[model samples]
Target: MSFKGEQHPGVQAPTPDSQGFRLNHTMLRIKDPEKALAFYTRVFGMQVMRRLDFDEMGFSLYFLAKLDENEQVPEEQGERTVWTFRQRGLLELTHNWGTETQADFAYHDGNAEPQGFGHICFSVPDLEAAEAWFDANEVEFVKRSDQGKMKDVVFVKDVDGYWIEVVQADRLSALGD
Candidate 1:
């Protein structure tokens, strides 16, 4: 699969296919880029791998990752500080200058109505341990369960109310095979 003249990763060049296109990042507008970055880094244990500035647009983008989930960082201060990008998954935190506001969406607080889009999902190896962490940390979990062959799933909200889905990767496989 390819698209827009960009060759698909496993397909021949010079032509794009729609099926080859994949998600690069999920962009979210935040009230404070610095605060959001810190929250994600400290809570999820993700590190800022790269940042790009759009001076003309007055916005900035950041890339983050888990310490051991990717390749070794060239110069990390400690074991837990060596986050890297193992795959294409990324969170794009954008800050628009002088807005002091966040767009109404899954990341924002807009009553109990989910507004269609509601959460970002992450896979963890252990359901019990992850749920315990959320409970001990006082994070509000929307749901939790072990669905037999489907995999154990848990949902939690961060400090700013962004919902996160934690599940076993095996759950995704069960749906197909």
Candidate 2:
């Protein structure tokens, strides 16, 4: 069978390439991109790689990266972008001015316990130090236990009320062999 809007005569369909698939970045709609950017930069220490203004769309898009990989840093310079020393993952902040700019996604849902989408998680070195950093910044967290293999996890929220998990493990072996 032939696909729609195609002018090929007895040609085989092109197969999709799946050899090198990797996560590029994650995008999230934020009520306030400015506040979210600040929270991620100051608290999580993510670096803003590039922020482009879409005049047509009437919104601003911010691309942030974990500051550890110097090579992955965007070569673009100038703009209201901030970068920090966190090398875990990339966070994309989308700010929509005209429409409703908000989210109610939680990372986890356990048996009808006020569940939505849950949260994002990151591994840190010291739990005490990490908790202290958030505490100093007037951030609140809920320590999580009974996580099966992964215990001693702490739950925190960003400026936009997004859940974030902070996990600490002493040695590599502790994560399981």
Candidate 1 residue-wise lDDT at 44: 74
lDDT of 1 by residue, 1-177 (tens): 434464557866434555556565676666677778867886677778777788998988777766476575556434322232334577867777765454543345433566655678787887787778777767677777564433466777765667788887765664642
Per-residue C-alpha lDDT of model 2 across residues 72-165, encoded as one tens digit per residue: 4435464223332233367778887743433553322221367756677777888778888988998866554334466667787776666788
Deviating ranges (above 4 Å) for candidate 1: 1-20, 67-87, 99-114, 146-151, 171-177
TM-score per prediction, in order, is: 0.63, 0.65
Worst 10 residues of 1 by lDDT: 77-86
lDDT of 1 at 123: 79
Candidates in order have lDDT scores of: 0.66, 0.67
